[model samples]
Target: MPRKPTNIIYSANEKPPAGTVLILGVQHATLALLFIVYPLVAAAEAGLSFDDTQLFITSCIIFMGIATLLECLPRPGAGMLLVQIPNMAHMPLAVQSLAAGGPALYAGMSLVAAISQLTLSRFMRALRAVFPPEVCGVAVTMLGVALADPALRRVFGISGAITPDLDLRYALVSSVTLVIIVGLAIFSRGMLRLFAVAIGAAIGWILAAYLGVAPEPNASFATLPYIDIPHLGWPGVSFFSWALIPAAIITGVLSAVDMVGTVVSMQRMDDADWRRADLDQAGRAIQANCLGDIGTAITGGFASASSSAAVGVAFATGTTAWRVGAVSGILIILAAFSPRLIGVLTIIPSPVIGAILIYAAAFLTVAGMELILSRRLSDRRIFTVGLAILTGLAVAILPGLVGLTPEWAQPILESPLSISTAVAIVLNLVFRIGIRQEASREVTTADNPFTVATEFLEYQGDLWGARRDVISMAIPVVAEGVEMLLDTGVAPGKLEVRAHFDEENFDVALLYEGEPITIPDHRPSPEDLLGDAHAVARFVGYMLSKRADRLVLGTDGTREKLTLRFEH
Candidate 1:
């Protein structure tokens, strides 16, 4: 059955206040610090000269500013109608690809990837029903599982190569960082809890610096410091760069997954019902993602995702009122003019940042896993999803094992995100639709005992085992007067007629013209009725019997209508 129309309205007039912009700006800045660092470091590692690095960084900042502005601004029929930011998940893959192929090739791949995703946007709504909560939950869980090892390696300062001769000092720094993070999470309150990762990283950095475990601070800030335009280079679509296509597609898929989760979370937070229109809104959101990707690729950066931080900030500060897109734009532009700011961020010890990310990623992974398990699937479905996720993780960890297979199969086997998404999609199709479960017992007026009893009472009031409708005459008057009574703060349960009707009738019944009136076996509780009086009244109105012969006349000469009056 189609869902009933929702009366709840989400309008521009309901936006957050102006003062909330400051809070949102702080959130953007903090997440910007975390998100931008990886791209800068990646650019530096990809053999870009300092000047080139500065130029790339400046362009990236400008791109982020532009995307953020488009996302946060209240555009007319453009934008996601929500705040968006650079996606973090795409960074690792983009960076890895950049390491193999130079910046130009990386940008080229990104352009293709963005265009593919953009073209695919229209199909997203059509495909969404296929990826129900269960399927998406499994896919997201698999993504986290695949990334877990890399996150750990970063935390332990074991990037590039792992050896038996482990650095004891680095281990100590990581251990202490982990402890501080865990402690703060357990003990902190409010804003402190929210920023526990950042604070923990700061503490670890301070300690690491004191012990000389930190990287040498290159404090010479003289680098090209001006806003630079993005250099658009055509990527080589050769077999070598084509190897990067899987990663690009994975980036797009994961971005969609993340967006879906974020949208569902937002809907729950706002008490909004998901509708077909909402699905269109999501497609538009993904379409907007292509714009962010274009910006990132042109500027020699990785693709970005929606900012969960912005959502948190919006809720925490109650600042849903103003447009912070402009603020993010200005900040990014300012940062672009001073590339030295990027270098300053580079001074933070990698171990500290890695430790913070380790915890953050772990939290994200656990949450994603829980999202999968929370869906009420059968044991077989659960096992299938779990196995697929574990297989994806194994593929990520043992890439060489998969590489031993035929070269033709390498791409399909190597990309964990794609493989997992595919596996989940297939398994869900098999389990949910192909081998469907048998229908359980059906309930109807003739079959259900409760329904039969209620119908009996309606037909012959106080006859057989039927209950009387002594207060039927008063129902129409109360129903008519309810709107006025509700406006005057008269609680539905507290109303004398409501209580009387509930008492006399075995089940609640209402009568209306030309409608089938049958008492509902499971009448709502007083609390339920009073809390949502409008809904209850509307439902009662809907269920009332409209047949002229069905309505009764009271001995008092009152017109017997569906009334809330009954005898206890």
Candidate 2:
């Protein structure tokens, strides 16, 4: 049975508490720095001039602040009023798209993409039933699995299977950095763990400097000479780039899905009631993505997504106050005014950032696996889901296995997000439908009552002791059992026990007031025969007739404790 809701006092008006703001602010700054490093490096490698790189970084900061601010302080119907984070899933795809189209095309494609997402908002709710926890779990796990190789490449500077001569010096520095980070996380308490990634990166930067592998950090604040308006360019409408449309759509949708899941999970963890308005509020938070993407496109940067870091910061620092978002925006605006600082940030070594990325990606993978396992799927369902995930991963990691020509399928297969989404959807549908006939056949002749009785008995012996109060146990019992207990005058505090055959254990409990009581033991002697359900029902009926406040059955501590309550 579901647990009752508890009241919690939350100050939704004004800004979040001061403590939350600080914690969330720090977290936001850390993740913003970490996630932006990749794009900066990729843009630099693509032969963007230093000036362009600075502009890009400046735009990123501004957009991050804008998106974060809007999410925290929603504008009527426009914002989701939730914490948002940078979108990591779209990075590889955006980078590839940028590489193919250059700055102008990249901007145009991004603009179109943002518009598409906004247009699709109306249909977003319709997708909920199709992407249940089970399906989402598989897709999310596949996402993590697919990104594993890219993470390794960034860490080690490997190209495909071709490994470069080991940069032993760089490797050693990264190793030491990771060690310090892991150690701190394990040994340090509270806030220290939260900042471990940032701390590790700082240490790695220093080490790189000592090794003479890092360039001198830029400290000036020069404005870019060229600030062109984002003029619309031709969209990448070729078959190759057009295939990317599905990938883009999947990214947007899955991101929304992830945000929803996060909100739901946080509410459950906090033991708060989930209002319908909260769902709509979450959707509005995603609107910031559209706005952020527009700004990113205009400034020749990749589109942005909602920031989970913001949520973490909010929770940790109790900064639910709206002013913190304003503070973050102010800081970002200050960053934009300083070109040299942005320049310095753009030069951080890939391996240093890559080390952190690798760890975080691995963590994501583990979390995905946990999500899958939490479904408690049957073995057959497991096999189907596992097969789908593996197939999707193979398509992503080993495209050659599919034997498709890159020229023809490269665009579609380019992103793991798209490939995995397709695979999961198709396989999930097949499995769900394929098993229907078998399920129907089994259901026709299945003895559901016997199965339920057997399960109850087994649970009683294995999980519930004979001396256990049935009323307390009944609290966690299924709905049917709960109704049955209620019908028996098992009020809040009374206890009753029902015993099955010796081979089967039975236990139940009913909540009385806020407390629960244990019922007396019910043990059958060797000579005494146990009655069937009809007889058990009669005994319970008689007990209810007597208005007994407490009833107990079964042996003590040996399982099979059944208790019922009659009063508050």
Candidate 3:
């Protein structure tokens, strides 16, 4: 098993105290509820009746709760502390569906989107190569980048028409909230850091209320029942249309891609030794997310996706226990029945939520940059990452370009997460055109043997996208092994070096017309270490054995082969 990250207070399998779990669960549920505003936006756009909108929100929350629970389980889930919420990205298409055919059309289109996600999830394992580290990095980075507009808009009170005084109050509240969260996460220890976001949000809410910046509940709040059972808002049958199918399918694919990045972020948070994404696990996560969307669809709710910003919250708060996520799921499901709880959560100051999102975005952006540099970079990879970023940014910086895309493609082209991910995957494949997984070169005493071997391995490592540590370890061990072979007269003539990488292991084989050098089972004694040429050669052989994870001595036809194998 890989090491748990030191910053993570609780891992996926570990259980926190019930009290702590409940507290954290409430925190997550509160965050997830904030996204319910998206469904409300669609409801208003479609001009639904108040009761219809209420039913839609209730059903969405219930399914999001169910999906959140599934996401905490290992079999159908990505098994991380992930929260599912209404997907704002799908809001436009959902509105079109709602306007054209009412709740039934919206539910049907959402089901199609769910099926689309399910289809993509099945092939996630096979598509690993298409989502290399840098590509995944771009997706994760854009997840953060996509949050920037909403976060800043809320922080500055620019999302709504506001007086200058109100805008300043929003800024003040958001800044204070952000500072408390960041300062606690950075400077405090133990429980303070564990509840950084919760504490910050609490303080921000209080300040907002004091300043009259927090939303005031209307007289309708007094008439709303404290608890009400949730029911399906529309009939269960799926509605389908050739015209809407493209939008639905594209929405599903984009959600799947978004889930991929979100799962990767969660994986990185839990494991200190995170190498690459566990796409198999990620596939299961996508499946879980799709299941949630399916529930929402059948219930006449909106489409849903895993929340990337919530992962940032987990990272910032230092807790990612599945127990906490499961607890949050329960609360969310219960909140669907509790109008009072929903009412209280709904009034949370937008600036406060914006501060929390800003905090998450900061962490995710930096984490994505680190992930991008985790592997050796070649010129091809540099362009793949650089150009993908530019393409994704263009969508954000130039909103008019979304209008240029066909209606079917607009859903994908409009979002930074989808556009950057598509560009990165395509560019990565395009750049791999001439790059081979295996390479070979000849080295001899006539040439600078070490330099020849070093350059060959470095180039191949970059081309094959080998782990940096693996390549770094391989270079020196191969160099020393070659010197030992020639010095000990095991291979005095020219040699052939062949390198191969399969993402899991890196193998370098040296073929020569000589006998195999003996690697001692134990470390060489002081006498042997200080002894003549042969003792020195034996000592080098022993050290080489220690360097590589496995050292193989074998023969290929008439020539003897020495191979160094490193686990990536």
**What lDDT tens digits, residue by residue, belong to model 1 across residues 134-220?**
555655555455445655675666877788876666666777887776765566555554445556667888888887878774546
Reference-based lDDT, each prediction: 0.52, 0.50, 0.86
lDDT of 3 by residue, 419-481 (tens): 999999999999989888888898777666678777998898887778888888889889887
Ranking by lDDT: 3, 1, 2
Off by over 4 Å in 3: 160-166, 517-539
Model 3 — which ten-residue stretch has the worst lDDT?
232-241
Model 1: per-residue Cα lDDT at residue 481: 34
* All candidates in order of TM-score, best leading: 3, 1, 2
TM-scores for every candidate against the unseen true structure: 0.63, 0.62, 0.95
Which candidate number maximizes lDDT? 3
